[model samples]
Target: MLRRLLGSPAAVSGHLHRSLSTHCVSTNLRRSLSTAASSSSHPPWAIIDYNTLVDDSPSSWAPGACFDPLQPPRVSRISAPPHLLRPRERPGPGTNLVQLLTGHVTAASADGHLLLTYYDIIAEGPRASWNQTADMEVERFICNPISGQLLRLPYVSGSRKRICYHRMGLLTQPGPGGARFAVADIVSQRERVIDRFLPELGRWDMVVGLPCQPTPEREMDMNQETVAFGGRLWWVDLTCGTISLDPFSYRPELRFVHLPTGSTLTSHIHTKSESAEERDEVAKYRRVGVSEGRLRYVQTSLHEPFVLSSYVLDEEASSWALEHQVELKQVLADGGHECKNRPPQIAVLDPMNAHVVYITLGEQEHVVAVNIYQDKVIGSAPLQNRYHYLLPCVLPPSLGSSQFPETGKKGDMEAIDVLVSCGRHYKG
Candidate 1:
């Protein structure tokens, strides 16, 4: 299907196959840095990407961050430097077209950093014919949008090639020199392993192997976003619960915390049978995030007398404490919307405000901010895309200088791409 749609990978443009270089910052980064410095802002923003194909519209390729702390939440797009979009090192002059497929805003940290996965296809050519399937390149980046600084992470090697399945997240630790960060890749299969990448070390270290599964009854389905809270990275399986580990610990210990009692799926047989689209639809009603320095889980009941329930994890990582429950029907009626049957999609948890949550209501997906405590709709705006991965990020007080640090070992780029049904091309 991808081959028929993309018309043989040779259809890519020159901008896609360019070689990567060591430039501190591009003109775009400098402009963004200037803009961020002057703005007085709130802590968290709703970050999402336009997963649609790239056409003549430039905004389609960029990821957007929606700021709702103040009234009328506004959204702005974040653009990547041209060099970061190309191959880290040139394969050859004969390299065929490498289509920039899409960008996934996989995770975010407390320090306003984002973990991005760029999907690209290396067209089959004489030099690139080692594989038959699309040469999907695993390009992982730690980007601070406010600082306009970006760091391309080194690829994890020594095992089989890295695909898009491994769950990853960004972990940040502030130090005297500057804010240091690490990438936690939770590789789960027959066995689960944790890989940590610190810039100072310049390579991925296989930290430890989990002694046992998070649950003995069924395997974990961790498709939701990973949360960075309390100096640890929390990988969430929305239907099940969450598994957290402090990536910085020398002897990392994995801990499991299930969803609020009665929220977890009792059996995996039904969940496993649902298609990916079905799973995404289910995610719209459930989410876990950090708010007011505590881990919170929120979900909307599927049946009527529709209710939105929120829970906060206890300090000891033992269990979840029920926080608030807002009746969605009453809220909708108060807001003057008559569509009682339309279920709302849980967009994001207000990282700074424990009582407020964001949701996309109706078919238009109008982004609405709701205060669960008061059952009031405070702010809203229309979102262009229906299917999106929304991430809540806290922008720092001041932007950091654009300093592209050295990762010691030369970086490697693996080429394998999957083209979705989207009709346009997107360059990230």
Candidate 2:
């Protein structure tokens, strides 16, 4: 489990969808830093990535990983340099015709190499069993984020039907003595429309209408991102559903569960102290549950900052649905949709502690930590666009806790983080 979680190519885009809107949220955080600085006020740079949340001792999670208090930090008003420009125009990534696609996503890739993009493309169609053969074949490509090195898996030719690509994550599984990179493609065996491929194995396979679980196949209507945390993969199903993938399992699958009803969440909000104006504002934003268990999608018609929603997953369902009864308000902070929707690309790592989501934001070539634990934007920095976010992953035997530094402020020794502003992509 430790090594399998660490090996990936890097920078695969994944993310969740917003409620009551048509726009998409993604995490390839590309910043064109060379462009002129605009009037737009950038985010604050004071908070350190690691905080001394606990007073006396260092955070329990601090030792093996880094709670680097002295790490270089970014000043509030300063912005990093711009990104290197590409030819002004040409065939860019994701612009090709025969590409694997869906509108919504949650987490893109667990490691850097095999991206685990997600979609609520499933519709409320009908039921299918893992045992009951739907007779489908699915296929998709696992492409390189940079060179576009694609490994195409052969299609089940002349099958008279298409397969569906459910979801995939780059896994470093314990193969005898060590970890090996593998793409765990959750494909629907039914003559599913989506197909998938493994670049490492040089193999082809079918994707499907449903996963390996026993839930009835439903047509998902929305888009969502795929996320990796706690040694597993997770995403929100179109109907505000969240799915968790077991990283340790051989035949990878999501144990489905249901989320709290939207009304259950919104109705529970105490409107008592709210002013009429505030009440009106509250109406715009509600804490509606998204994933099964305790998580909710806290979205608003009003665009203030980001609001955080969180959940717990029940590991025993066949189809995607909510699980537990313990409700958590979690982190209700201000977040612009930029982190999820605005990235040019993204990468993820289990990092043994909590999930570390890396997006190269700005035209500046920087990685941004938009939200951690649902509330705070831990840190940000200017980084190479070509650099994969997967390279720094740490496997579990988890060194310590996954939380960021307890001390919100950078140490006196060095700055804790940095930021980069993006410019327009250069058309050569």
Candidate 3:
């Protein structure tokens, strides 16, 4: 009966108006039958030759997945390399989008716009090798998702001054594009440590402030070590060695925490009698990132690639406790260089999403991107230039609108991009 429907090999091929490409026709038929049986309600095994049931037509796809049929086609390919679009691709009466040179970027959503944190954009002249002729400038790119436009805050307060801690990055969503971001800066003109706000709905506001502290010299470290989680800004203080940050509710709290050590993760592997020294060493840690108002970290003194440790913050008691410790080797596979570098800096790429992508510079100065979700090293690339990088942000999602809006778009997909930067190399 089965053979009767398909007819003979030559007859079936003729019916389909095509020749069989593979000799294993019987095996292919078996698999096709299995799939048809699995979803019998869909259709029958009408030997269509190829099994690519794709309708790339925008009309066949769901709404938002494609564009409206009434409007002209709104989709087209985005060309790169020789076609890598330059800013002012065609000079017109439009906004000057922030040009991201070789640097780190992390964008998240804030009030519906893309809050893009772009670090120091160093200048490198192709002809002169790498010689800078000007002072560094810190810039923040705020792109409105709806308009597909970006705004650059090149100078703070519209003056020649720069923003504090432009290296590490500003807070936003967790991806490779602009979302939204919040920053905390102390007023230099006025002696008040204040929290600045830039909500999706309106302008910046001084929402919070600290008592007082001695200001560092111009060249010294003045950046507030900040991370965004539970919806607010928080940081690790080197002077006090404690975390002072804002929660999702916009309240500030200070907590003491420590990172985990390789020794600790190893002891868990084997050993009934774990040494006291090993235990003591593992217990001591530093702030890494926070999750659900809980603090997380990794061992600082560790000279080798090890595990990532997170500590949960006990607000009532004002103390820290261990939460999760996943072996860094399990993900990194190769020994991480951040362990080789002295004071290691690592941050959970996105806390909202369980897929944590940690960014750290290794001994060879390779910036590694580790995936916490799949337990693997997703990306490892060398920094093009040199400047002690402070912040690296994972950008948020955006419209990434199709170039030819006049063309009704077809099947489009989502993607993630990363932003990172070294210090001020080209002063220009």
Candidate 4:
């Protein structure tokens, strides 16, 4: 009856086409059915069997049953080259040098060759009392580590005799062909002031006042470096709160942002120190840095198996979130480091990658790079140990002389003044 209704070949084709078009069957399903029917001539035994037969014997074993999916991934190890293992040399003229000063470290521009350093003088004269001095002179000068070029920062006219250099932050603004950089210095005398050095202006000008004044107790406890991130300068106060200032703002704007609670690393070791204050001070170790245009906070303990906790600023929430946590012992073991000394001190997070960090092991003479993302030590480089002080700074290649012009004869007087007044600040 169905054949009679279809009638001729044209009528059958029309009926098939109408069925397919009307969703009787999909085109792919029809094609697959036709192909399977055409290939069904072979015997079942002639077809190659690709599936493995289940082994039910007592001696037989299955590998998948023994596999553990919860196991941690293995870590990769990297080695430093022979040249990097040797003591670092002083950067020559026109070379990029990231100089680490007494109380501060530098973050150099990736495109610029020069590193900014300063000359400071701390003179101690007759004292009126044991804690107070009769006369103190503080002079500061900005200098280039590569060319030995010095530029005297104009002193705050009619300021107090005692002045302290609090912290410095360097920010580079990208321009058409090259970039321009600005330096913000926090100087404290009777009052704390923020001074900015504009490359175009060629002089230090007071920008704004600090939100909080520095007392002798808090002055010694400030972070060594002020980080430049999110178009502002940030300093971690002694209480681990972040203080920020906008240098480009028309009004003097300063904001204090409290870090999220429980973000700091705490130690469980009980010290035998007689003073309870000393024990409290030894309970926490913190470092503030910038990574990937965001502010980062790092905390670790002073003992072995030093566990590190890292956090990044959450801009939307205006808080910090714990990002990474790892043990220093595991990192050292993976790096083939067998030093019996104290655990390395985390210096700063890599600005280019948030997962990498720079650390300085005590008296090791080399800076180690650990990639927390991969759970390994990627590399190490010898640090330039001057005056037994090892300041590990990452220095990129210099751009050119046109970007950072040499300080010629006009800077001669400033260099002379720095040499004469800053002699006492340098310790042999």
In candidate 3 the C-alpha lDDT for residue 230 amounts to 48
- Segments in model 4 whose C-alpha atoms lie over 4 Å from true places: 1-152, 158-163, 175-181, 187-193, 199-204, 207-220, 263-285, 339-341, 381-398, 401-428
lDDT of 4 by residue, 28-143 (tens): 32122123223222111010000111222332221110000110111111111111111224345564332111111232332322223221212232211212322233234332
TM-score order, best first, reads 1, 4, 3, 2
lDDT of 1 by residue, 1-428 (tens): 23321222111101122121223222232234344444434433544432212222322222222112222233334444333455335346666654444445667887777776555555555423424566665566676655444566776773223653456888888765556888887776246578888777777888546664355355665657788999989887777788888888777777788888898776743465664445455676899988888999999987765799999998788799998898887786787654447777787888878988887777745777788988888877776544354567776554333223443234442211111111111121
Count of residue pairs whose backbone atoms collide, per candidate: 7, 116, 42, 0
* Candidate that scores best on TM-score: 1
TM-score of each: 0.76, 0.35, 0.40, 0.53
lDDT of 2 by residue, 159-278 (tens): 313333334444433334322333444444333323333333244444444354434244321123344444555543433345556544434455444444452324223344533233
| Candidate 2 global TM-score | 0.35
What is the Cα-based lDDT of residue 287 in candidate 1? 90
**lDDT minimum window of 10 residues, candidate 4:** 64-73
The per-residue C-alpha lDDT of model 2 at residue 267 equals 28
- For model 3, the stretches where C-alpha displacement exceeds 4 angstroms are 1-139, 144-148, 152-155, 161-183, 187-192, 195-225, 238-287, 290-295, 303-308, 315-317, 324-428
Relative to the true structure, how large is the alpha-carbon lDDT of every model?
A: 0.60, 0.28, 0.31, 0.41
lDDT of 3 by residue, 1-428 (tens): 11211122111100111111222112222222123223222110000111011112222211111000110001110001111111223223454322222212222222333333322222223312322332234344443322223344433454332434321324444333334345444333133334354433233445334432232221111122345544544444322323334422344433333222232232242244643233222322343444333444434335444556555555542445665556674356554443533433452323433345444444325555565546666656554323222222221222332111111211111121111110101111
lDDT of 1: 0.60
